[model samples]
Target chain A: MVDLNVFTTTTIYASVLALLSLGITLIYMTTRVFNFAHPRLSLVAAYAAATFMAIYARSAHLKPNLEPAETSIGYVTVPFPASFYLVGVVAATVFGVVAALVEYYAILKPLLRRGADYLKLMIATLAYDFILMAVLFLYNTHRAVKSALSNPLRLTPTSLSMTAYDVSIVTEGGTFIAGMFIFSAALAVALAAALYLLLYRTTLGVKMRASIENPPLAEVLGINVERIYAIAWILSGATAGLAGYIMLFATSAGSLKPISATSPADEIVVSAFAGSIVGGVNSIFGSIAGGLLIGYAETYVTQLLQAITGYPEMFQYARVVSMAIVALTLLFAPSGLAGLLRSPRARRLLSRIPVPGRARGGGR
Target chain B: MEEPIIVVDKVNAGYEKLQTLFDVSLEIPRGKITVIVGPNGAGKSTLLKTLFGLTKVYSGRITFEGRDITRLPPHERAKLGMAFIFQLNNVFAELTVKENLRLAGHDLPASVLEERIREVFETFPRLRERLDQKAGTMSGGERQMLAMAIGMIRKPKVFLIDEPTAGLAPKLAREVLENVRKLNEQGYTIVLVEQNVKAGLEIGDKGVLVVSGRIAFDGPAAELLARKDLAKMYLGIS
Candidate 1:
């Protein structure tokens, strides 16, 4: 019998990781830069959600009586409104977009104009990661001082979590799934679908593909490559932000048992990069698969290793597992699983799937 | 002749550290084909790229129809009725032929774009047959034709074509040259860089021979074509 808890937890982790990997893939495809600061974008978003939730919690606070209760009564802790969570996601998304634009206009654009080498550009993004991480830390410290709320660095957003309504079933041995798990998973699916439509069916999508194919020609054809790049950045940032907000819930609800943000986004980022590489950075769908594969592996492998070795601390080797996956993927299949699907046989197989706008007999 | 449509006045340009064009100037007469010919290290291609605002102009002025466009970006120049077709990677390879045409006519209204696309399809029937085929899959000659068709869709005042016949069969090369002549007949001022000196000079109204980052001769195409001494001395042709 499979552990239902581990399965659900893996699904939740994979869902948010898929979102983050998609964001990573989007920015890489358009700009030809691997943004090391991408994980920080999510952290900023999580902070934004946390900030909004803290504000709401403060507003809804009930001042405790200085005198002791006659029977030592316990005051009830009410959950924040569902609308507050939505507002938090929105706030996080906006902040993510703004941060991405600032990084583009203020740092990345100047480096590109100066014809900085790829290594220099990469280092610049690393610097940006630390800079933004410092900003998140400072903001966390500031919030702790300004409102007397829980410390962000020490306490996860679980301290201000919305109540989870579980849906229990009387089937087989009795099944149970938390409402938050379903909600976050649905959001991930919707985001991926929206991205697919935007990339394949719209005028902006055509422009984006043209620019990605050949930037100079696209520019000559009057596609406004700069604007397309800006759009890519915004989309990447927004997706990263939304993923971060969802991750807070996933972690708080204990649905992503394998991962949680303790200090910053270092661990989640490692898994995301590993997943992106395994999925093939060029294909959005591939990233989703890669993320899920890593998500499941991280959870199950750690459990199996711990059970076999009788070492409770064996879960710490999960990062090692991700590193190994990345190395093996690069060595054996440099193009990733998506690259394999690009083969003639795989393409022919896919062609039979009856997708719209993909009529056969066209030249490759 | 009828006030040159684009005038390059003593331009010095290059890419990054190395200078490629030194004090070169030329005038492109309206609705006429001007061919640039030179030996292998001459600044022929650079001259065309510089006029289209692709290279870094260290010092000089480029005036298009009496408007100073030296400082304009490539797309801005493209908007102002100038089209550049490179020797390689001229079209969006990943896109289908129809998508490529649509993208070229991005500024046009949908109805107008459809009409213009139909016009291009009529001009190049082979492209019409392969409308849904990706551009990258086309043969070299067909790709060149598609490149020209994309330029035509833009309806530019001047066309800057570089090495249109560099990597084509003799028959296809001649066919491309004939299309260039046909385009000129339709009243497009053209700036062409070609390695096929005889055919290029025969079709051009004016010719500028560049050598070692300088223009060695600028005059009637027939005269430069006939001058064996100038041809052998600077153009590396008998």
Candidate 2:
């Protein structure tokens, strides 16, 4: 008997992680920058959503329902209007895009023009992440001060989770799934499909792919490679922002606990990095698969180890599974799952391993 | 006879602070192939890149059709009736052949691009057969043909081709050179850099020899080929 709750939770986490991984992979492909600040983009989105929801609830004169309803499995004490969440999503996405553009135009673009190498650019992104962290901390402190001075519903921007507002749907089998799970899963599929269409069906997509493969040639062919890169950054930021919003509700931690400005992002960066690397950093679709695999493995492997060891404390080391997966992937499949599938030699090697349903001489 | 299609007036250009071409000057005549031959590291490709606005020009003027274009970027030069084909990694290797052709004429009107692609197919029928194949999967000779075909899709007035036969077999090299001649015959001015000095000069209308970043000889191709002294001393054409 599989636990429906665990399945839903894992699905939500996988979807959000997939979005984050895609953002990282897209930015890397276009600019060749590791973008250490990418995880922070989601943090910005989460804060934006928190602030929007708080402001909207106050304006609408809705009482803050900080406690979960009896029927709900997760959070969402108040019956806030759907428009509140919509505004939050839009705000998060816009802020995400703005932060990404600032990183590119203000930092990466100037350094690139000055002929900075990959190492310098990566370090620059790391510096930008620290700067962003400080900015977010200041913003959080400001919000805290304002919330203390304000009237009724105590909503601090530093501590926010959409799960407090989420509704749960009970199934016929006496189980339930959070609405956030459905929303995150649906959004992931929609975004992936949209990206595929944009990259393969449209002329702009062809130009972008061309620029990614060969910028000099694309430039000589009269394509504005810089403009293409800017567009990619915008897309990457949007994905990160939306994923952050989704993550706010998807997380299963204490509803009332205050999360630090950086803690949520800090917790997920390794998993996101693992996903991108396991997918073969160069392949966007591969990153999505990698993210899902890592997300599931981190959860299920931890659960299995705890069950086997008969120790509940083993769950505290769940990230160790992700770390181990990253290490093993780097050692055995450095090119990633996509690269292995693409290479004839790798495919031949994989065929000889006699996996179930494996075809012989399938190398193309 | 007519004003040369492109005039490099004592141009000093190179990568950032490297200065590969030193006060070199040359003119590319209209409707003919001008071959640039030089020893290794003699800046033959740099000269071509300079003409295409790929390098930093320290000083001097480059006039294309009487318009000074010393500071224009590569894409702007491409828009102003110039096509540059690189020696390596010239095509979008991951893109399909059809996608490559479409991207080459990216700014063209749909009907015009379709017509141009058709004409390109007529010139290189092999590309038509491999329309769905990735450019990287093609043979070296086929890739060269596709590079030339991509240039043709633009219908530019001048083509700047760098070592189109750099790593090809002897037979394929000759075939590639023959295609360059055919492109010239179609009234497109060509500036080519070649390692095969004798074969390059054999197909060229004018030969410009460079040694240590300076032009050692610039004259009719047959005249340069006939000079046994200059050939043996610089080009190892004894």
Candidate 3:
């Protein structure tokens, strides 16, 4: 039997998944275009961190003790913890902005001007998805792994769940999977709130909403719909990129093999997709909820499959269970948990179907 | 007068070579109710889109407020104080009526926006009651009202309403018309395209009839409405 602590762990994992899922949904609602490459943006963020850390490890300017020499690979490099992470964050943020522009200039801007429907724009995204995956895999391949942490995260191990990715430089702490998850979760909440404020409280956000809601009408009223779409893409993608970096710390994310090489991030992409679609694929919160729900399900079912069948190979079951749940959710609740929560009748019916830890409210 | 708020000079436009508007030229007076009445497919909406920068202008220039805004984007024109309400109900169905109005404010300062909202609520009290209700749930009349409120919230230099009374009961249509008149009287210029010939001519300062992508008739509203040919052929009286 799985311990109660395991369920708690699953809930935590689900919350982390919710972050990127929310981004996907937010971008979708605003532009009415699915950025299938959103998960890849997260991958980009992870690599950004890794690359920054890699460079910081051994710069003669940063650390005079380390002699910069040419290695068999090419350039001799030392890892610096402090500088690398900073560079990674900046790089990832920049990449996110660039990605948004690419989307705007290449697909959305033109499609929007032409008045393309949401579904048609999605086709372009599907194509862009493959191209992004290929490019990210190619880019990540240029890096080498380092076990020595010159600069590391400054947080409690319990808070971050530090992994032993590096033992040589023990003084510098690496943020463990747990830390990454927590950081990402906090960031997601902050981001969602900020975005809500921007859209609902600010004029720029309203302009964006107006443009999306009624383009021809808004244009007549002298609102710059094109500018709104462009800005929305850039800001939204930056978050997606940050989420990518968080995914790396939590798991073996950002491993891509090009030209017949397989990438581990491909697998992570599956869960992210499930989270997005499960959450109605249209709402930002729905995506986040979908992510966390799937994350917990994955962690929960994997344990069950392992315990009952004595199977160490339970990854497939985790995915399958998540998929099954997703399918049921789709069929029963196309609007997702949000939709169900919206209707009083549905809430009443759901209260009748009891689940543990769920309080049966009066359904008022 | 006042350099004509909007001027479309010799413009040709089409939908992929299937020409919709041809060599159309017109001037809209500031703060006046200009109505374009025509039979179906007379390119009334097309001309509006051309003027609003929604369609391609093959030959002539469209100027708004003395600026050659022919090639300017629709949203840019909105920034220049122009608003268009489509023939179909164009309110954000998923949003509340108030939410839709707020979106129209488009970066207005918070205090000013709040004041504007209050004033608009006073103007269209029906919207006040359903501020939080989703626009989709409202009746056809209500949806049109929401759209009109969205347009009026910005207090644009010129507002083009396509078939304003479309899909409404006679009572509701008259009510919507009254709202348009009230707004026009408040110093907002309006360009209305309507099917109700008698009522349109009676209210509008001038009536322009578009025929086969060209202006077939243009004159005072009463003069056009009084013509037997326009009444029988354009008004579909048979």
The candidates' DockQ values read 0.56, 0.53, 0.50
Per-residue lDDT tens digits for candidate 1, residues B52-156, read 877889999999999999999888888989899989999989888989998898888899888888888777789988888889999998999899999999889
Expressed as tens digits, the lDDT of each residue in B39-147 for candidate 2 is 9999999999999889999999999999999999888899999999999998889988989999999999999999999999988888888887889999999999999
| Residue lDDT tens for model 3, A1-364 | 6453354345445654676666676677667776666666655555555555445544524432233334443333233344544575677677766776786688766886687888888887766767776775555443232222233333121112123222112112321223343455577677768878987777776676667667666666666666766676777677666755554444432221211112334555577777887887766667777887788778766777787899888755677877788788878888787776668997678768868754533222
Q: Which candidate wins on lDDT?
A: 2
Q: Residues A103-162, candidate 1, lDDT per residue (tens digit)?
A: 888998999877787788788888888898777656655645335445322234323332
Ranking by DockQ: 1, 2, 3
Name the runs in model 1 displaced over 4 angstroms: A56-78, A143-148, A151-176, A252-264, A301-314, A356-364
TM-score on alpha carbons, each prediction: 0.89, 0.91, 0.81
DockQ (0 to 1) for model 2? 0.53
Ranking by TM-score: 2, 1, 3
lDDT of 2 by residue, A11-128 (tens): 8888877888889999999999888899889888777777777777777776644454554343334456578778779988998999999999999999987789999999999998
Error of 2 at B108 (Å): 2.1
| Candidate 3: stretches off by over 4 Å | A1-16, A60-84, A111-120, A133-177, A252-262, A305-312, A346-364, B15-18, B129-134
Per-candidate clash tally: 0, 4, 21
Model 2 residue B58 lDDT score: 93
Candidate 3 accuracy as lDDT: 0.69
